[model samples]
Each structure stands twice: as structure tokens, then as C-alpha cells.
Target: MLARHHDPIAAIATAPGRGAVGIVRVSGHGLAPFVQALLGRALRPREAHYLPFPDAQGQPIDRGLALFFPAPHSYTGEDVLELQAHGGPVVLQLLLARCLEAAQGTAGAAGTAASVLPHLRLAAPGEFTERAFLNGKIDLAQAEAIADLIDASTAAAARSAGRSLSGAFSEEIHGLRDALVHLRMLVEATLDFPEEEIDFLRKADARGQLSKLQHMLATVMQRAQQGALLREGIKAVIAGQPNAGKSSLLNALAGAELAIVTPIAGTTRDKVQQTIQIEGVPLHVIDTAGLRDSSDEVEKIGIARAWEEIAAADAVLFLHDLTRQNQPDYVAADAAIAHTLAERLPPGVPVIDVWNKTDAAPGVQPGSAPGHEAVRLSARTGEGLDTLRHLLLEAAGWQPAAEGLYIARARHTEALRAVDAHLMEAAAQLESSGPALDLLAEELRLAQNALGAITGEFGADDLLGVIFSSFCIGK
Candidate 1:
């Protein structure tokens, strides 16, 4: 995978289907010969020339506009060729095959002797953007933003991804890196001038510099947190005993009849999920089967799946029917479900007790679930649902949509957190009386490395493979 980038690559650059126009793109070193051989002439750089893209017999496959970009001035930092043709799968496929055939010296007619390009092949998914990163045209964060922009689910998400692609996120990472590098220089210099170390440290205000960096990192982390929330929304699972109005709550929240609403206890035997956006943040809500001991084999499987979803959930809504709050048996079953939730849920997962059917029992005062706040609502009438929405957003730790927010991945936030940890350790070493300068220097060094990983300065090959492989082809 690491060595694949050295080869010239070709692929259809447009979306699959019938459209007004489609494009076949090629990129690599010395693509001039390939272009001259396929198009029957050497075209000027960066100019669109109307030409006939020919097959082996000098047969015109299609007449289209061809644009050429030379090395160091293209999207992938290599020579690039784009053929704009009529939008049809067959035309694009034939054009791509002809390009490959000419490059690989497999064309039967063999009209041009100088047209063969050595090591030309098809591009892998994201290989174009990966080359851009590898050749210093963009950093890892910006490369990732290309994918985020293509996959953005909402307008706000698309805008945020655009910001990231333009280097807003990488700029912050680079800022941290620069600051960290400065501190490391100061710490390392102390060893070179040991006799003046005490006076130098006092004059330079190392402690003050460290404090400022920590503050800057704190602010950056908060922004990244918001960005990550926008990029990867929270997963919420709605669960409870039989007939607690779980499906009704789903319908009310989604403002649609997504899940079937019936008095029957086990109407939903599998998980039903819908993604709803609140203030540009996506919330994936899931409705699970009614929790109960049953003789039916299917219900048992559903109950088991519910537990699995709960275990992996970011938040859970434990639904309780307001009318049944007074029944001893109903209350006991709710308690048993609560006990299982506590035992099975991972630590830090929020559970919001939702009391449903408020219209059915208007006089019943809903008690909050123990150890957590409760939201009382009638899913059928849409009462108190707005309150529930706000609480779920709070559980997700999302703030009001802010200005200049950039989309970030889970890895970006995790890397920032790791940098923060190292900075904290360095701060401790700086504060200790008769501090060990070596320890302080090591911490700062590690902190910079962690920060560098965000922009590919310190990333591993496998990490690159995992990141770029997720991108759409021809990007």
C-alpha cells in the first residue's frame, strides 16, 4: 500500500449514472507521453482542448474536452489529465480502458511508438487525495476533510467540513505544534547552559509560557469537541418494559409513524432507528423491544439485542408508562429493568427517565427515575417533547451552533486529548521545586509528537491506509 502511489493511475472521475457529462481522470509522473499517444498530440498545460479520444485503431471513442495539469501544479501534486465526455457508463469505461491500454502497451493497433507509460494502473479509493497528502499539497486533517465534505449529511455539516478542508482545523493543530516546539527548545537549551540555568529559567518565565499553552490547548479542545459532535452524532437507544410507549415516543420525536404503535406488548421485536437533526447535530434514536421474560423464542432474541444496544449506547431513554406508575407489579418490573441497565451499561452512559402517556393519567405526578433527572411527556400528543430534545442534546455535550466551527473526526479529538495529557505532566515537572529538566523536556517532546500526528507529521503508514481508504473513488 505504501509503494502503490509511485504508479500512474486512471479512473472515472464522475458519479455513476446517466448525466449530462462524465470525466475520466489520470495522474502520475511524465503523463505527457500518455496524453500525446492517446489524443494524437501534445496539449498545452492547463488548457482545455477539444479532441477526439481514440482507441487502438485511431478510432474515435468520443469527442470531448481534455485538460492537462503538469507536475507540482495539480490536485495530486503530479501531472493530471481529465477527459470530459458525454455522460454514459460505456463511454467513460471505454475511454478509461483505452488510456490504460495505451499506457500498458497492450493496444492492438499500436499506432504511436512513444505513447506507452510504464507502471500505469487504476487508482484505488482515495489514492488521488492520498497522493496530495503524501506530496505536501495538504496535511492529513485537510485530506480527511475532503471525505467529510463528500459525506456531509446536513448543510451545517457540509459547511463545517468545508472549513476543515480549507485548513481551519490543521491551523489550530499547527499552532499547538509551534508552541510546543518553542517550549521544547527552551527546556533543551537549559542543559547546554547549565551554569546560567537558574537565572535563564527565571528570566525566560518558563512557567508563564507553559500556563499560556495549557490555556490555548483548553480552548482548542472545546472547539474540537463541538466539531466532533457535529461530525459523529450521538447514538441513543430507547428501552423499557412492555407497553411503556417507547414506539410512541419515537414517533413523536421523529414527527412520523416510523415504529408501529399498538397496545400489543411485543409489536416491535427488533430495533427501529431514525436519525433526527436538532440544531444541526444528528441524533440517532433507536427503539428496542419491550424488556420482559417471555416463552417466545423471537422475543428472547430481541431482548438480547436490546441489551447489546444498551451496552454500546451513548445515551438511553428508559420509558415508563405514567398510568402504570401506581401498580406494584409494574413498578417492580421497572425497577428490575433499571437494575439491569445499571449493571449492563458502560460507565458514563447517560440514562434519561422518560415518563410516557401523560394524557392518559393527567393527575398522576411522575416521579423522577432514581439517580437521574426525568422528562414527563405524552408521546401521542407531543407534550414535553421539546424538553426531551434539549436534554438529549445536553447529554451529547453539544453547545449552540457556533461560528467558524470546523468538522473533526474522533481521532482528532483523541489526539488533542493526548497532547493535553503530556502538557499537564510537563506542567507538573515545571512546578516541582528542584525540577528535573530532562523530564520536562521529554514531556514537551511527546506533546509535540502527539500534536504532529493530527497533521500527518508523526502518523504511521497503517494510520494513513485506514484514513484514505474510506474516501470515494476518483477523489
Candidate 2:
């Protein structure tokens, strides 16, 4: 809990640089004295007063509107003050310096100094929200949502953050936690006096509660995954033999010559990546060197790097040249890649055969392969690009109504997955060996803790620091 100190914390609560107005914010019990010193007069809470802000020597710094918000109802659950002034960087800096000077000194009578005063310090990144959390103004989940709102990249991301800030995510977690507690209470009551013969653990109602808990957690995990995908886009890698039109496909998809197209083989001995948005979904398109056997040290090194890239990619596009007849070298190249990636690629990674250069070849239909469903198109002419786009979207499970998606990090997705795993384990324990109630209870508790980490109900110290410090100042 935050200490109810008389001291105040101050910061420029608006973004830096030029704007219509810049806001210098202060919050705590000592706001009254701080305001009087800076404004050259006392101010009534919840009222906006126009006044000339003064420097340390009583010289006028700037004329601005001052606002006061009394304690227990303000953002930090403390008395808050806001000075709205010209937004120029230089002017704001001078204004901020004067405010700090005013906060540090004795209490003032009109424009003169008095004996007693309150101490104030600058707010750190996310510190104001942290204080809000400490003071019960907002919960851990809502506090994190505030930071997410500031960093949202898309409209859907912003909306999801807003929902979480409004306690949508927290409400779900709390509901689950409440159910767990009820079940734990029932189990503990039975285990406390086994001789009662009531058999409380064998009741149908207990099983129903366990089942419902599992189902609710599963639904939340799925939604969290979607939100994470919307927040952090997938990494798609393009890999194939040399001269398979990989570079051309990259250029076509990216709408620019991001990579150099050439007829010569082994031209690209490095990986090139371009970020493109398809129907609002960001795709990190990585073009890797053509996978092949090479004696040249540089080419071999690039080929090695290409394998690493393919292994890390969310999906891989295996490009093939349809115009050229199947040759032994091409067959061997494809075979080598297939054997190398037998265990490396994640399950369900879309490995589509991309048939490029269809315009140069005659009588070949520009479509998928025979019984293989390959995407046939001319990368140079932009044919079948739309088909490829649709395939990518389908592979990602993207839908038209994806506005419900929330932005989540990989750590968040992993945590949710771990929660799901534990919940399932707990469900299994509920029915085994006369109901291992203690282990089952522990598993449910662990599951709740994992979910809690996503919304900051429970988090490692380093993680809390990392999450908040990443925020922009004045946020």
C-alpha cells in the first residue's frame, strides 16, 4: 500500500515538444503549499484559476491556468495540481523547473514564503500509475492497461487495452479466482475431518466447479492468444533454391524493390526482411538465401544462417520455379531442405509450394499444384498475389471481426499457455486416486497465478520493472 504522506510528486504529464498546451502535474497531500508557492496565491480544489506562475525570485515565468484536485478522489488518490501553459519545449522546461523549485521550498503566504512546506519529487516512468495502484485507485490489471493504451499500434489493440483498463480482463481473472477459492474451501473442509463421512469431495457439484473452471480458463487463453497475435505480428520467412523467384516474390508482396532481383544464382548470400501489412495484419517477411549445397565459405555460411531463419519463422514459403522442368539438382535441393527441417519447424507451419514464373511458361494454369494445392503465379507480374495474401491470412486464423483482438506479448501468451496446462493437470487430478485434493488445489492456485501475471496481479520483480520502464515518460 502507498503511504499517505504529505509530500508530493511532480512531472510534465503531457507529451514533450510543441502542442496547443503543456501540462505540469503534481500529486500528493502537499499540493496546496506547492501550488501557492508557484502560483503566487492559494487555490481552491476542483477549480481552474488563471494566474502568473513565478520563479524562485518572484519573477514571472509564464501565465497559465492552474487546476487543483483534492485527495482520495484524484488520479494518485492524492491532492493533484495541473498547470496548463504554452507547449513549446523551452517554455515548458523553464516552467517545470520553476514548479520544482516552488515544490521544494517552504509554504507560502500569497507570494511570500512561510515556515512549513511539503517535499515533492519527479515522477518516474509509470510511477504515477504505480502509485495509483498502491492507493487502490486502480488494480494491477488496470494499471498495466494504462501503459498498454499509451503504446497501442492499431485500433483493435487500443480498444482491447481500453477494455482491460475498464476491468474486463481483471473481472474474468477475479471470477476464476473466486471459483477456485470456493472449491478449495470445500476440499479443505472435507480433508480437515475425514471421519465426518460426509464425502464432500465426491459430490457432483465439486466436479462441476472444476469443469467450469477449466472451460473458463480455456476460453480466456484463446482470447489472449488472439490479442497477442494482433499485438505482435508473425514472422514469415521465404526460402527456396537459388533463382526460384524468392526475391521477386518479396518485392511483389512488399510493393517495392526491397531486395535486388538477379538472374545469377547465389546472388543473395544474406537474409533481408521487410515488414508489410496485409489487411491490417503485419507480416515480417524475411527473404533468406536460397537453401543449397555450396563449397564457397560465404555461401555456406549464408546457407547455415538461412536454416536458422527458417527454423525461427512462424511460416515458410517453399518457392519453386514452375517454368523449369524438374531436374536432379532441383530435386536434391528440395530433398536436402526437407530432411534438414524434419524436426526444426514448429507444428502446423504453413509450408506452401509457391510456383513462380507462370507467365514465361505456356499452357500451365495459374493456380495451385496437382493434388498439392500450391500457389501458382508470376511474381514479376503480380498474378495470384491476392491468392497468396488470402492463404497467409487464413494460415494466421485472421478474421474480419478481429477488432476484438487485444495486443499481447510473447511472454503473455506463454504465461496463458502455462496456465492452461496447469488447469488441465488439475482437472485430471480431481478424478484420480481418491481425488488428490491437495495437489489439485495447488495446481489450481498455480494456474491462477500464471493468469495473474498477464494482468500484473502476480509478477516477478524484474518483469514489473521491465514492463513499466519501457513506457514513455509523462505517461
Candidate 3:
């Protein structure tokens, strides 16, 4: 990715569709000649000029707005040219080709035999934002937040991503790193004067500082977990016997006829999925085929696939048919399925016991049963759905923070966990009868590195490649 940074890049910045207007963005150093060849005159910096975008034959391709931003003040911290033209796809493609041709012609007119400007090519995914990071305009976390904001599925997630893009997450990480650095400085100083009789850490109350830092890191980790839930969402599988209203529950939650619901048993021969948000947290709900022994080959395959989805789910909604609970066969089948669920589900994955068809069975109360946390509801009538939604949030360990949250990814949570682990080791080192200051300092340094990686202060080229490549081109 770094090797191509020196080359000028261009791409259609807008989404691939017809709209009122489209944009073609060019970014790199020394774009004055290319701008002149395309626009026929130098554009005023930061001023919008109505001009004709020309082709290789000096004919107007489209008349629209032309804006130029000089180096150090633009998004990439380099010279940038934006051409707003008609939104037709073909028109945008032609304008893009004309820009490249103009670059080639401009280089030839300047008599530069070995010029790289003529080699201007289409920008790869996320090249513009990568340049912004390289130019120190934004950190790695903020760059990721830009992509998150664009891809957010819910209002809360979008707001959190916006906060992250504004550097809220980076600022918290930086504050933790600064505290670790301060402690490291004190510990390193103690090592330098080992002959001194006075204890530097004890005099400076380093242990107290370490305690406070641990508390702060825990707080950040909690918020990061909630942010991750908002970003990645929860995968919930609706599992139960045949005709337990799993499909109806999915449709009710989604507020659309996303899944086919009927009285016929085994209507769903495969997994039907939909994503819905409850209180601004996305819930990826999958209504799988009924779990049962079947003679039909296709139904058998679907039943097998249902188990696969159940195993991978973050939460499982075990819907029971309240009207059929009195039947001997139904009771036996429910017990067998419950045993399978206990054996197959991963440890720590929660299962919510839901009794459906309550509209037909009004005498049954909606509360916990013996040795089970249960919610009785009618999927057909939408009764007790509010309780189910709140229960889902509680099972996922989601807590609304007093302050606004910043969107975070799984990698961010892992990094925070690493920092917390190192801090724990440092505290243990301090508690030893004869404190090992060297080990303490090493833990502090490790903690700082893990924390710094969140904001790109400590990262590798390959990691950057993986992070930025997920972004849309021309971002």
C-alpha cells in the first residue's frame, strides 16, 4: 500500500447509481498541470467555479462545478481536484477517462520524459482515507470510524461511529497510554538509581496510581463491549419443534412478512434470516427449520442445518408451544430438544425460553418456570414482545452508558483486554514481598503498546492493509 502512495489516484467518489450529481475525486502531489489541462485554467483554492470539464480533444465533456484544494489543507493533505458532473454512469466514466487523459497530455506538454503523472490510475479501496492517516490528518481508529459510520445499520450505531470519527475513542485510549507512560518513567528512574536508599515508587504512591489506572481501563473495556454489540450485533437463532411459531416471531419482530408462517408443519425447510433493531441495537434473527425427526430427505437436511445455526448463535430463542404442553408426545419431544440444546450450545451462550401461542392459552402467566427463565408471549398477537426485547438486551450484557458511546470493533475489544491483563500483572508485581521493578516496568511498557495499537501509534503495515481495505473506494 505504501509503494503506491506517491502516485496520483482518481475515482468516482459517489455511490454507483444515477443521482442529481456525481463526483470524481483526484488526490496527489503536484496536480497543478493536470488541473489546468482538465479545467483549462487554474482553479481558485477552496472556491467553487462553474466550468466545462474538457476531453482530450478540448471539447466539453460536461459543464459543472470545479473545486481545487492545495496541499496541507485538503482531506489527504495533498492537492485535490473535485469535478461534479451529471450523475449518469456513462457520463461519470467518461469524465474519469478524460481526467486520466489530461494527466497524460499535461506531462507530455511539459516535456518530462520520465513523468509518473501520465501513469495516474484508478484509486484502490480506501486509498484516500489511507492517505489521510499517513499524512497525520487522522489516526487509524478515526479512519476505521469513517467506514463504520457509512456502514452503520442503526441510529445508535451511526451516532456512536460519528463520535469515534470525532476522536472520542482515540482520546480515551490516549489518556490511558499517557498514564502508563508516566508510571514507566517513574519505574525507569528507580532502576537508574538502584543504589539510593529511598524507595521511589512508594514515595510517589505508584501503587495507588496503578489501582486507579486499572479501574479506568475496566470502564473503557465495558464501554467498548457495548459499542461492539452495537456495531457487530447479536446473532439469534429461533429454534423449537415443528409449528412453534418461530416464523411468526421473526415476522413480528421484523414488522414485515420476512418468513413464511402457516399451519402446515415443517413449512420452513431452510433458514430464513432478517436483521431488526430494538432500541437501536441490531438483532440478526434467523428462523431455522423445525427440529424434528423426519422421513423426507429435504426435511432431514433442513433439521441438520438448524442444529448448525443453533451452535453458531450468540443467543437462542427456544420457542415452546403452550397449547401443546399437555400432550404426552409434545412434553417428551420438548425434553429431548432441551437436552440437545444444553449439550450442543457453546458455554456462556444464553438461551431464552419463550412460550408461544399464548393468545390461545390465556390462563398461563408470563413469567419464569422452575429451573428456567421464561417469557410467555403470543407471536401472532405481539403480546409480551417488549419483555422479550428487554430480555435479549439483558442476556447480551448490553448496558447503556451515561455518556455517549464510540463505535468499536472486535479487535478494539481484544486490545483493551490485553491492556487490562498487563495491568493486572503489573499490580501483582507491585504486591510481591520484594517488588521486581524491572518486571513492573516491562508490564507497563507492554500495556502502553497494546493501548497504542488502538490508535495506530504502534501497528504493522499488514495490519493497516487489512483495516483500510474494507473501506469503499474514494473514501
> Top TM-score: which candidate number?
1
Q: Give the whole-model CA lDDT for all candidates, comma-separated.
A: 0.89, 0.75, 0.88
Error of 3 at 38 (Å): 1.6
Name every residue pair that clashes in candidate 3. none
Cα deviation at 52, candidate 2, in Å, is 3.4
Name the runs in model 1 displaced over 4 angstroms. 105-110
Error of 2 at 320 (Å): 2.3
The alpha-carbon deviation from the true structure for residue 428 of candidate 3, after best TM-score superposition, in angstroms, is 1.1
Ranking by lDDT: 1, 3, 2
Q: Model 3, range 67-117, lDDT digits (tens) per residue?
A: 999999999998999999999899999999877777776434322323336
Which residue pairs show collisions in model 2?
227-406, 369-374
User: Using TM-score as the measure, what is the rank order of every candidate, best first?
Assistant: 1, 3, 2
What TM-score, over all chains together, does every model reach? Answer: 0.96, 0.87, 0.95
Using TM-score as the measure, name the better of candidate 1 and candidate 2. Answer: 1
Q: Between the candidate structures 1 and 2, which one is better when assessed by lDDT?
A: 1
lDDT of 2 by residue, 173-232 (tens): 778778777877776777677764146666537778888887887776677767666666
Comparison by TM-score, 2 against 3, better one: 3
